[model samples]
Target: MLRTAAAAILGVTVLASASMAQDYRLNPIYQTISLRGGFTPDPYVINLQSGGNNDASRTLGGSCRGWVATAPDVRLHFQAGSLPLIISANSSTDTTLVVNGPDGRWYCNDDGGNGLNPSLRWNSPMSGQYDIWIGTYGSSRNANAQLHISELYSQ
Candidate 1:
């Protein structure tokens, strides 16, 4: 009976750890912001660090790259309209961008922004939560970065 109980505990622990690995279902590390198309002051900027232990390419699949945390850096509850939604990262270190769109699709970018930064745009974006993850390109190390969310331009 003791062995069975210990096995059950071990199983639960493993399951919990597995679930936490690069799971977008978790809450963001920063904060949640609500915005509508044409409601921003052009760009909504957020200061944050990029990179984490989880491998973005393996966890997020597709063309995703870089290393990212389990939880998102920021979550954007966006109400879309005629304008496009642009998400970008600006950092001295080479950085990557990963977004889980409201439509349950994953978007990733590398060097789409100015210099070595990353950016992704959704023209006619969906209205819901956008889980944004900013990551370093080379390895799993946090680096200073500014996340720019805009309807007009990217940086």
Candidate 2:
């Protein structure tokens, strides 16, 4: 069940359902990332906070104007290759991960890593913008999550 949630992620053009989707962004907006092969640059971690509407009536950030809560989007340009991305929250019960890439495809992850952490590798990633959505499973709890992103490919 978990394996397919991300694989079947809706395309970027697809609007979220009635439950509402999140709009995330990095606290410090970094446009482009520099990377060399075989080098894991220091992971930039951001605190995840979500706000919006479940009815799809409210939009938070620019990327989520028609969507829901605040899900951080890191506008990045990397070398054309597979970029290994690691996104983790405080715990598995806290959050899920969804990414919208330059190709206009959505990549999602639900509890992929140990203790609900989500990780994915974008193969043949185009050099452009990316929408990184941190979705909270349990809305009753505060939106407390940490995102760790690393550029795994070098040009």
Candidate 3:
């Protein structure tokens, strides 16, 4: 019985230390729902108009962007692993977004075409969970943007 208690305490200590070693603080996602982006190359749009529009910092992985938001603002699963992982937001509102890939890399985009919406793509990333976010092109509290993910392939 004593040995078991000691082991439990050790496990807690290890976990605490490991979590403290992260270079980027992935804020707790109190609100989020993970789902497939379908099994095609079509873009699936999710409503993030009610998302949180505030992040402690705008510079993720050493890249700066607009109003940065963390999970709950956006969180997705890249099940379909083909080509590149595409993340885009509504262009009309100047909404920027980023992807904190499973491989400890930060991917952000300010604009990808049509208008001021931001889009980012990860080339052949390892299949896993990713933390998605929605931000602005500069710094604003506008949380009125729609988010979309495309180029996904599912089995």
Q: Write the number of the candidate with greater TM-score, choosing between 1 and 2.
A: 1
Deviating ranges (above 4 Å) for candidate 2? 1-40, 50-52, 55-74, 80-83, 87-93, 151-155
Model 3 over residues 19-137: C-alpha lDDT tens digits? 11122356534334454434443666766552245532333433435655444355565564445556667745666555556665565555552356665554554576666667666
Taking all chains together, each candidate's TM-score versus the true structure is 0.84, 0.54, 0.63
Model 1: per-residue Cα lDDT over 47-138, one tens digit each = 99999998877775556788999899999999998977788888999998877777666777887767787777766689999888998987
Q: On residues 15-47, what C-alpha lDDT tens digit does candidate 2 reach at each position?
A: 333122443334323233443323455455555
RMSD of each: 13.9, 7.3, 14.0
Error of 3 at 11 (Å): 42
Descending-lDDT candidate ranking? 1, 3, 2
Highest TM-score: give the candidate number: 1
Overlapping backbone residue pairs in candidate 1 total 0
Q: How many angstroms is residue 66 displaced in model 2 relative to the true structure, after the best TM-score fit?
A: 17
Sequence-dependent TM-score of model 2: 0.54
From the highest TM-score down, the ranking of the candidates is 1, 3, 2
- How much is 123 displaced in model 2, in angstroms? 3.8
